[model samples]
Target: MTTVTTRTVTYQADALTMVGHLALPAGSDRRPAVLIGPEGVGLSDVERRRAEALAELGYVALAFDLHGGRYLSDPEEMLARCMPLLADPDRMRGIGHAALDVLRAEPRADLDRVAAIGYGTGGAIALELGRDGVNLRAIGTVNGLTTGRPGEAARIRCPVWAGVGSEDPIMPPAQRQAFTAELQAAGVDWRLAVYGGALHAFHHPPVDHTALPGVGYHPRHAQRAWRDIVGLLAECLPVAE
Candidate 1:
């Protein structure tokens, strides 16, 4: 039988009090850990549930906050905060580090066996963490194909798996090309998965907030991406039997 326990964790990052969702597997033994980054809208039930799912699989999971315990439902509001944050790699790294510290402090977490997976703005933050040279077993992102400062990707010490909707306007072909080029030049072990006929934010469920053009959910692609992310972890940061 499998059991999962969960809790709320509050921490400080980027001058804001962040409330994160933490989930642990059934066993008392230290296990592989995963850091989950939410979309620009911030931490919501959507991400919280993902953490719980990971916990069911025997991985310590934490879904970190981005907007001080608030979920930004308005598109303009979300972009206002995320645009600047995304442009500043240091700030993104700071957010990632703060959450990582919280996860590492957990008794159930195996600090050395950890991965970072995120979506949208959260995905950008995860990539920033890897680029900042944080040791990670794997780095995965969905719909957040962001490029960092020149040569910064060389600091990444793990394999990277990025998924994007082929029709995503926000992360168009040029953007994806630039991001991939950086990883290629840095000689990082990176892979990209493009889901055909999908739009930006396709992995997310339909939001209750004001909708953004070119943003909608693709249920099939979403499940496929999740499988790929799980596959990445299994290959790089597998849980012990």
Candidate 2:
């Protein structure tokens, strides 16, 4: 196994103090970097493990926070915080740019080669970063196909990939169509993967606590989505030896 180092990082986004986890491979040379966004519920061990796994693959990865360092397990609280934030693309871009600043500051990150991938609310932030013309190599999101202003999406310079469950009530067929239409109208290179019989947050594992309705875990689909995300990174931001 490759040697990997992990650390907790704290940074600021406007007035908000954001905390994130950074993972780096055992190498002095700059490598491709990945910015990971957590779900609306906030950052969790799942995202940290994802960063670790990316480090193992030789990429510098940062699992960024959503609500400072708080993880909202209560469904109502999560919605209260996320819904309004989602409605405002500028706020989402601010959060993503702050985390991107931290990731790019890392010694191991290759600033010119970076990707953004996120889950749920985190996914929306990733998309916002791309829409804001952040010059990402690629963008990937799961259960985060939120559409933005068409003019802004035209600024996205990289390919975009998104995954969602067919049964996801939150991102139903209509919403998915709108997302795709926006991307297409903006001329962005994009792809969407729909997993059958999976619900919202299907990529997440079963937690000890209950979540909102229409959200559950689908182990098989989760693994498959991870493979697809890795494939996107490999295609767009391959690490150099």
Model 1 residue 30 distance off true place after TM-score fit, in angstroms: 0.4
TM-score of 2: 0.98
For every candidate, C-alpha RMSD to the true structure in Å: 1.0, 1.1
C-alpha lDDT of residue 128 in model 2? 96
**C-alpha TM-score for every candidate:** 0.98, 0.98
Q: How well does candidate 1 match the true structure in TM-score terms?
A: 0.98
* Candidate 2: regions farther than 4 A off: 208-210
Model 2 lDDT-worst window of ten: 204-213
Tell me the lDDT of model 2 at 161. 97
Off by over 4 Å in 1: none
Over 131-226, each residue of candidate 2 has an lDDT whose tens digit, in order, gives: 998989999999999999858899999999999999999999999999999999999999999999999999999873235789999999999999
lDDT per residue (tens digit) for residues 1-241 in model 1: 5899999999999999999999999979999999999989999998999999899888999999999999999889988999999999999999999999999999999988999999999999999999999999999999889999988899999999999999999999999999999999999999999999999888888885428888889999999999999899889988974
Q: Each candidate's lDDT (Cα)? A: 0.93, 0.94
- The true-structure Cα RMSD of candidate 2 reads 1.1
